[model samples]
Target: MPVPNRPVRGVAAGVPFLAVPPTRRLDQPAPVVVAWHPMDPPRTEAAFAAALPLDGLEAWRIYLGLPLCGSRSPAGGDEELMRLGYEDAVMNLQGPIAVQGAEEFPAALGALRGQLDLGDGPLALVGGSMGSAVVLLVLTEADRADDIAAAVLVSPMAQLRPAVDATGRRYGMTYPWGPASLAVARRLDFVARVDEIVRHGQPAVRLIVGARDDPDGFLAPGQRLVAGLADRYDDPARADLVVVADMAHALAEEPGVEPAPQTAPAAAVDRHAVHWLRRHLGGTAAPGLGAAGEEP
Candidate 1:
């Protein structure tokens, strides 16, 4: 499939452009991983690292770097995003930067569906931070939202107001910006949205949150996601949560900064998530580890 520079613009004038990677020829229906990278410039690396080791996926991968991070080429190659000015400030602040991306999801998803021929097989979503928020919105708002088989959310932010408040507490400064428009979050009904997806009969979701990830407002949402999905599944295979102690939401550590013990769980979290996806998406068995990476 050929990918042109053509972009799909929706109600929001500017957001992160969506990138659909090239597909490989397969004898069977190709599985799809539609991923949303964390909100920031260079969106590819951070979210990619966080969701690594997708053990059994032999399918096309579609990556969405939230508004301002730039995009990648479709040949499964990386292209440097132009030095857009707003990337820096938006990354540093917790505000409505990614709101456009969430709002524009229908267009993005449509473009991807057409490009990848998503009707071929199962679809899975992986998101981090702002990306996670967008995934939640898409799962609730898009008509095909319930069609997603499984989801893995890393440091998802359900409420930006609370996140900004948490950031102020951490840095001892006052920042009033919230994630999305307050009206939007309320209109969507964050918790209820998650429940709606479950009620529509989607499979389980994997949630990875940093126990020490204070600024992101991820802990609360991670808890709420589990609680919301509790009654939906008898086996409850869809509500998996892993709290990495002392870990923060940052995907990559700064040079010379020693990694915390809790940070090790990042890879473990990815493995657990992939294993679950494989099982649900019809992989042979759990990939090299059990769910949650628990020891037998």
Candidate 2:
């Protein structure tokens, strides 16, 4: 079955989302896979949905807009975001986004489930870059942490301090890593909180990174996260890392606030994500699935 020409779009509990229904099992309640877009390219919910639709996966693929992003951007838009980043990247931008995104998700999720008539069973999660930090926060701190069945993180910000450092280097500005920012970094460091992530359900986790992404910011922390999870998981294979060749940090072009064509790297990441969700969510992949240009 082909995906709808336009996905079901709505705002639930103050969170905007794009929902792609399963090709199979329309009448029955389907498992949900909620995803958060990165602060980088393919940043908005619609853009992220276009980038990684998880084509042919038999589940509800819900792309959620992060707080202060997409339709929820402040009055000054990207300019405001940049201003916040300059003011205090951690306290003003990253910290609030991560904390608010995680805090607001449960209500949004409940509203979505009620509105869509989705299954009450554990759902899967997917996130990219800074959005991946939101996923980690949910896994570690959300009351519904135990309700997550699986997760896939792409070019993830597993550790916030390195990402902040990388940003500082990119713009040739030294970040003032004060006590407040350092505390925020410590809270957002997923690799340091692996035990909390698996304390309840031990959800299957797969971290996918681009081979060309910054090793210090993304690759190294992802590797460390997998290693830490491996030590805790009953089956070490439940925690895995995949490095995609010829790929980089961002999945789409600059000014990624709108939906755009999916890139090859994004497609590759989607393939891995779909396969993982299928295995863990008890769904089968459709024939010829996981190909670029295919719809959800």
Candidate 3:
């Protein structure tokens, strides 16, 4: 399939998104894959789309901006985000983003369905770092959990406690885990809620981590998630982990708020994600084309 020169930019239910339609399926209802970006490089919807455009895949790739990110950032910008992390990374930052992002997804999806030629078929999800937490929350808690066909997580925050601790270690400060924070941690901890994901549909889940990501925070938890889901999957291969060499936590260079040229590591991630989505969503389709405009 030929790649589009640019993605169709739009807002759905107040969420900014960069959408790329299937190259040859403008007349048909195409499979849709909604993605969320990490807090690191390729942090925004446009940037993530540039990094992992999923070219050649016969699906609509819609990259959505996470809460308090991109156009939704506070007035103080990155400084405000840092302050929130310093105040209480879990309660003030990570926890809220995951919860809000998950909560807002259904309305965003519905709006996108109304605005685009999206299929009613099972959806696919992709997320990175903290964004992955939102994806897990959706799988475990969303009313449409059973409508998920596949998911791909990069440097995922599968367990929240370890991630908070790891952040503390990196910044040389200890996070005083209190009752409220602990409760948030438990709620965001997807490892402990594997049964919920399995109860829904046990969608094909692929976790990709960089070789240099924090071992305790990201790598180990991702591995644990795959292991937890192993027995639950009828085809064990549906749940697996892939470690990319020469890659770190962030997928692109610094100042990842805007769209930029893709990095080597990001290209590698794109390949893995595209392959996984193609394999899983290849045969799926929407019943009819909606009001989405022509491909860009």
Candidate 4:
């Protein structure tokens, strides 16, 4: 199911609200949608604090919402990422901070669970990039293993090697503790821990990846991940790799930033995102955001 509008604009930018509320009544159970934040997200808590959207849909579809367990990308929460760039010799020393960052993920889950401590419904994780990977990490290591119902992974990372490599180059670290080196060495590689989650996380998983999204949407990020999972694409949606005509990487950039216009295929993928989200969260699936330009 594609989003109604192309590029899927958030009613508000920089603010991602989870639809689930705190006082969830037992008589009326609802699913909780946990959106894993991008690496080092801008505002982890504030993103979930805003009011979620409930219009457009036929029913009053709503669910518990929360950001995923952690962030690692360029969201800027990990102070160490920026701080390390200033000190070449000390950058590797600070690399441990990112590895240790996983510690915060579970805590966030615990907090979300506490907020939704009401009816016994279902919990689903919706994560993008490494945020999806972090969701796996939290669910695998948490006490409430049976709470999750399903998951949605968007362009997830294949391993930690890419992160380490990029971070090392950015910070000018000559030591072996670069993001890639440290990921495997520190045991934080996502691919290394899939088994732990496979046994615990349930229902099913829906993965959305751009056919052309190289690792980190460039090199071999998506490719490496897809290859790693080879025949395990249970419900895969490998969309066209068309870059939204004028869009940038940040689909939700700040004000004055022009939104990229995704082609019909991209629009369908985007709607599929919302469909999965609303269904697991509350709404039912409708026709996808695609039209008769091609295959059905």
Candidate 5:
């Protein structure tokens, strides 16, 4: 499938963009961020929307380009570095900036949550690819979502991006603190630190990654995320690998092609993810946490 120069934009049949864009809770408000990265959306988004019912919360999606593979060829290979926290600032690019990396994604979005006046409502994040790592960093390590009720991620990675220059490419993004954080994390292994936070932050998530979706660089990192989530989730198999028969790196042959709420394993898993999130963020038919396995 050939990726467009721009990220594809289409409102799911009924889902519409909010005009006021309330980032936080106002009156019995429910807010959720459905985040996705470039060369990747179909694998995660549609199902996530299907799984969750939009009875109450204002659901929104984050579309970005995450650096996962050196190729960036739109061939579905995700590797490279500095995708450290998927899309506060950096995502996939078509030309010169394609390989460039950035930090402060989770933090940036956290601030955006505030800037959007999304501050202090019920917040939840559903991210795919490197965006998954960003969710963890903001939720557990950076702790942007302390006020948030829950977060859900499908296919997250751990520290897959490479080391950036102390200054980094983004002007003043690191200036003093960013570099320091990355440096310290590099030595002590931030992955371990985040794992501890997830244990206690207690955000219930339904994480899924493909077994055959190995991009070499992305594999080990994605696995680490699986292991960490497995530690937190009791039924690791059900919570982690939603494996379909002989799948490849990309979920299917095309993007934006699948129907919502279907019987196929891919469709079911996707629907489950959406359903679980709507439940997480609170909907008319919302179920509480620890009830991820209840049928959609």
Candidate 6:
């Protein structure tokens, strides 16, 4: 059955909220939406701290709400992507950390550091598109390098500058940016930083992509990152890639590899990620809210 398109209701304040069933069983994962609706004001480290229940928190899984700039896919696809039902609780942020003009990348790291805590159990990172970029950025932090247990990156980009270049090439032209863009680019190199962390922390990393995704850019760079990981660890399977046959960017199938049922590709991606996470975290499911989107 097709996942029904549910109407998103916004607060009187205009922030989009994740609508979930009110009553949940103890055995089932609790759903929380940390959505950054387009209209909400920017957030700060203190704001992030206020939103999270980090006060002597026990076991919890943290799901960063990193939304792709242009993709409409709902964050993490509800029950489908979280098939293991391992999360007993979830922390959903409204969106990526707030940054001023040209401050997006670095400030984003600061926001992540303020909100992320390994807690008392295994922590897993999941990101799609730009959100994945944020995940990679957080892992690169020297102090936080060994904290994450595993990561799932979907349609990921390896660096801010190249991603911008890729966007220009795919869309047929480049736009102008101030010095800030260059600064962000120099500081955030996803592939290299991830490789550095993986060499020392050895966190299990999984890269999921659409075979023909952003054909001129996204796919090739992701493949290169995987190859680089193999070279760094000398184990091809340590950081592997899974290309869903008919999936497109953000797990949508508009530009599919082949004509598949509407749900097959996403289901396949979910299965692989959940299974790998299970193995990496020693088969113990962590707690988390089910989904997220760019906290705006």
Number of backbone-clashing residue pairs for each candidate, in the order shown = 3, 0, 0, 20, 21, 8
Q: Give one digit per residue, the lDDT tens place, for model 3 in 1-296.
A: 34354567889999998888766645455778999999988889988888877766668889999999999998899999999888888888898999999999999999988787575755899999988999999999999799999999998999999988887888899999999999999998888999999988989999999898889988999889999999888888889898888888899888887789888888888777777776787543233421122121
Tens-place lDDT digits, model 5, residues 82-176: 34334333222311122221244454454445433443445565555444555555565443445545555544444534212211343334423
1-296, model 4: which lDDT tens digit per residue? 11122112121222233333422222344455555433322123223112112212222222211222223223563455445544542234323433333345445445544443424446666554455555555555656654666555555544555654545555575445556545443454545654555556343455565454433532355444344343343433421122223322222323211223333433544455545555554442233432322322
lDDT tens readout by residue for model 1, 1-296: 43333323222133233333323345556667767766432145333533453544554556555654434223322322223212322343233445555677667666666654555677788777777777777776667776788888877666655654565576686644345445554643456566667755566687788777873466776677677777566667567787766667765443211222223656665666666666666662323435433321
1 or 6, greater by TM-score: 1
lDDT of 6 by residue, 23-122 (tens): 2222322222121211111121112212221222122323222232112223564342233122210111111221211124234334432333211345
The order by descending TM-score is 2, 3, 1, 6, 4, 5
lDDT of each: 0.57, 0.87, 0.85, 0.41, 0.43, 0.45
State how far residue 289 of model 1 sits from its true place (Å): 8.6
Give the Å error, residue 198, model 5.
Answer: 2.8
Runs off by more than 4 Å, candidate 2: 1-6, 26-28, 287-296
Better of 2 and 3 by TM-score: 2
Lowest lDDT 10-residue stretch of candidate 4: 2-11
Worst 10 residues of 3 by lDDT: 287-296
- lDDT per residue as tens, model 2, 1-296: 33453479999999999998877644445678999999999989999998998987878899999999989999999889999889998999899999998999999999988777776645999999878988999999998698899999998889999988877877898899999999999999988999999796899999999998889888999999999999999989889999999998999888787788888898899888888888887755555665433323
Worst 10 residues of 2 by lDDT: 287-296
TM-score of each: 0.70, 0.93, 0.91, 0.55, 0.50, 0.55
- Judged by lDDT against the true structure, how good is candidate 6? 0.45
**C-alpha displacement of 99 in model 2, angstroms?**
0.5
- For model 1, the superposed segments whose C-alpha errors exceed 4 Å read 1-27, 40-42, 45-55, 71-97, 113-119, 177-181, 187-189, 233-235, 254-265, 284-296
Task: Tell me how far candidate 5 lies from the true structure as C-alpha RMSD in angstroms.
Answer: 11.4
